[model samples]
Target: MAKHTTLKRGQLLKYIGKRWKNLNIISGNSFMKFLGYDGNGFADVWVEYQGRLLFLSIKEVELAV
Candidate 1:
C-alpha cells in the first residue's frame, strides 16, 4: 500500500530537503524536490524535475508522502 498526503502550504517546509512522489507529472511519474512555495500571495510549489526547475500550482500535482 502507498501512503498519500495532500499537498498543502502548511506542510510545504517540511517537504524540503526530501524527496516525494508526484503522480501527476506530464511524463507519467517522476520524483520531485519540494522547494516550498513562492512569495506571490499564492502558494505555488517550486519543484525540480528532470534536472529542470519549475513552478507548479498546488492543485496541479498529487504528492505521495
Candidate 2:
C-alpha cells in the first residue's frame, strides 16, 4: 500500500538533497533527488531514466516518505 501527503514550503525544504519517490506520471515510481523550488510554483528534481539525467518541473505529484 502507498501513502501520500502534501507538504508546505517549509516542510518540503527539509527533503532537499534527499531522494524521494516521484509520483508524477512523467516519472512515476522513479526516485529523484529533490533539488529545490524554482520560485515559479514548480519543484525542480533530478530524474535518472534510461541512462539520462532529466530536469523536470512538477506540480501535482505526491512525494512519498
Candidate 3:
C-alpha cells in the first residue's frame, strides 16, 4: 500500500528553502525546492529537472509518501 499524507499550509511553510524529495510525481522532477505559497491555494516550487529556474504551482493534494 502507498502511504499518503495531506500537506497543510503550516507544513508547506516550514519546508521553504528546502529540497523536497519525490515531488517529481507532479513534475517528473524528484527533488524540488519549496519556495512559498501563492495565496491562491497553490504552492510555488522550483523543479530541479531543468536547469532554468521556473516557478511551478502545486495544487493541494494528498502526497504519496
The model with the greatest lDDT is 1
Write down the TM-score for model 3: 0.28
Per-residue lDDT, model 3, residue 13, is 18
Please report the candidate that would top TM-score against the real structure.
1
Quality of model 1 by C-alpha lDDT: 0.49
Off by over 4 Å in 1: 1-26, 40-42
- How high a TM-score does candidate 2 get? 0.30
- Give the per-residue lDDT of model 3 (tens digit) for 1-46: 1112224432321112334664334333344333344455444433
Clashing residue pairs found in predicted model 1? none
lDDT for each candidate structure? 0.49, 0.39, 0.36
Model 1 lDDT tens row, 2-62: 1233344333222222234653344434556666567654446776765666676655545
Q: Which candidate would rank higher by lDDT, 1 or 2?
A: 1
- Each model's RMSD to truth, in Å? 9.4, 9.8, 9.8
Off by over 4 Å in 2: 1-29, 43-53
TM-score of every model versus the real structure: 0.48, 0.30, 0.28
In model 2, what lDDT does residue 5 have? 28
The best-first sequence of candidates by TM-score reads 1, 2, 3
Model 1 TM-score relative to the real fold: 0.48
Q: Write the per-residue lDDT of candidate 2 for residues 1-65, one digit (tens) a residue.
A: 11122334322211223354752323343444444444554444444444445465454333646
